[model samples]
Target: MLKEFQSLRLVETDFGNDVKTNPEVVANIYSSLLAKFDHNSDGVISLEEYMTETKKMMKDIANDIGFMPIQMVLEKDSLLMKAVELHHSASAAHTIDC
Candidate 1:
């Protein structure tokens, strides 16, 4: 995936691929991308790290949102939905116990 990501020919510039045609800037960009994606610094992106970063980004977006209700669509069987169900069930049980 990293190889594929690095192979993109997306950079278009007035000077034409800058710093000497298809140049060092691409490598620099990929290095920065790797640093961001490879959170564990193991030089690779694992599923866990990706998900952790994703959840942090979602929380950031949620925090940026104010007052307005944000609608999120999730499959009923998704783990997040299941977590919501479990919390509701536990709250109901706690009310009964009280």
Candidate 2:
């Protein structure tokens, strides 16, 4: 999760200040994302909701950091795909060991 966030250049700039490095700030960002993505006011976000919310948040962050929002969106997509790939590989390895 931290790696994904770090890949976002704008996030590193705007929120990258010392204050943003605090654990509390990181937790707040995750909590807010979860809350916003849970559209039905439900405690959980479906996969679709999570994707939609993530894109929106990325765009907002990009704009806030004075970068091209589209670039951020693309970067997010790349990061997500990488995460999925890693997860699948890890799961496959675990299954093989078992």
Candidate 3:
């Protein structure tokens, strides 16, 4: 993910893309993403947090993968769907706001 975050130039990944990779921006994103999975609010994500979040995400994606197209067409909403929308919106907004 960090590699992909570093590679963000022409396109936005989970993190925003920009013309430049400033240290502050990198740090902000690194910290924000780290905070997301760091359930204990620690500076680092524990192995348990990492594995649990990974498994949850895998289950979420696996369950929804088949219905994604239909969901998009139907505009169905859920916490995961809303979070993804907010993530993309915030990625763009954060770049501009920062």
Candidate 4:
């Protein structure tokens, strides 16, 4: 995953300044990802482990980057709040019926 992310041409470029890319950042990120996925710390993450971690990380990124503005809007909008409440009620009813 770190290799894949590094392969991405998403270099931070400022006009004429050479930004020093920290290899340690990639290492740290990979280490953290591996630790999160490798429950037993066996130096290998299985497919299931990878998928589980990927899903969790994606959800976290989504909540952090995508949901912040929506959450703020929800906080300000009574209509949205009512709609969310209605949806929650419907879901709860469905679950109870099930």
Candidate 5:
């Protein structure tokens, strides 16, 4: 699953196109990724570990990019888009006054 995730990440992030030719680079990246998720030193990441790490990473990102208008290329049916829709609905249902 880690290998699959790394392969997908490389493809998704437009890196390591030639995994066979550049095994060193791929291995280096994979090792770094493994080091990140193996936080408990158990050499494998469980679902709880993944979620905890992901949430921390997201929180760190939000803190670093605080109050900045974020523009992401999102699909219409994506979770983020759904969050936006929900926010808009709630806004429409309420009236804010100064």
Candidate 6:
């Protein structure tokens, strides 16, 4: 991955700046990101594989970049709350039907 990063010329670019500026750090981050989306037990990531693993990939990336805590607080909580509410409503409807 470090080789890829160096070959891809991520030096001083927007991606390099936003993420780790150091080439080694960027390489590590890139490797981890690729592993996150590498489904089908393969080392490569295809579009279909990536789409299938979207949620897990995003969560893994967030966790890797130390954004998981903020994400859970800001997004996961709301999504889980909505899911719980929907489940409760569905349960109530089922009870009424019965």
lDDT of each: 0.66, 0.59, 0.63, 0.63, 0.64, 0.60
Of candidates 6 and 3, the better by lDDT: 3
How do the candidates rank by TM-score, highest first? 5, 3, 1, 4, 6, 2
In candidate 6, which residue ranges exceed 4 Å CA deviation?
Answer: 1-20, 56-98
lDDT for 63 (candidate 1) = 42
TM-score leader? 5
After superposition on all C-alphas, the RMSD of every candidate to the true structure, in Å, is 7.5, 14.9, 13.1, 9.0, 7.0, 9.1
Minimal lDDT window, size 10, model 2: 65-74
Rank by lDDT (best first): 1, 5, 4, 3, 6, 2
Q: Which pairs clash (backbone N, Cα, C closer than 3 Å) in model 3?
A: none
Put down candidate 2 lDDT per residue, 7-92, tens digits, no spaces.
Answer: 45333545645534666666667666556767887676778888887776654554444433443234545745455455568768
* Residue pairs in collision within model 6: none
The sequence of per-residue lDDT tens digits that candidate 6 reaches over residues 18-90 is 4556756767777776677676557777888766676454545544544234533445565444444555687
Q: Candidate 1, residue 23: CA error in Å?
A: 3.3
Error of 5 at 56 (Å): 1.3
Tell me the TM-score of each prediction against the true structure.
0.44, 0.33, 0.45, 0.42, 0.53, 0.37
User: In model 5, which regions exceed 4 Å deviation?
Assistant: 11-21, 67-98
Which candidate wins on lDDT?
1
- Angstrom error at residue 26, model 4: 3.2
Cα-lDDT of candidate 1 = 0.66
List model 4 lDDT by residue over 1-98, tens digit each. 55654565355456557677787875776667657888777877879888777666654554454335554446544544545555568768999999
lDDT of 3 by residue, 1-98 (tens): 45544454433454643445576777677667767788988556678998888767855664555556654432456655654565568668989998
How far residue 90's Cα lies from its native spot in candidate 1, in Å, is: 20
Which residue pairs show backbone clashes in model 4? none
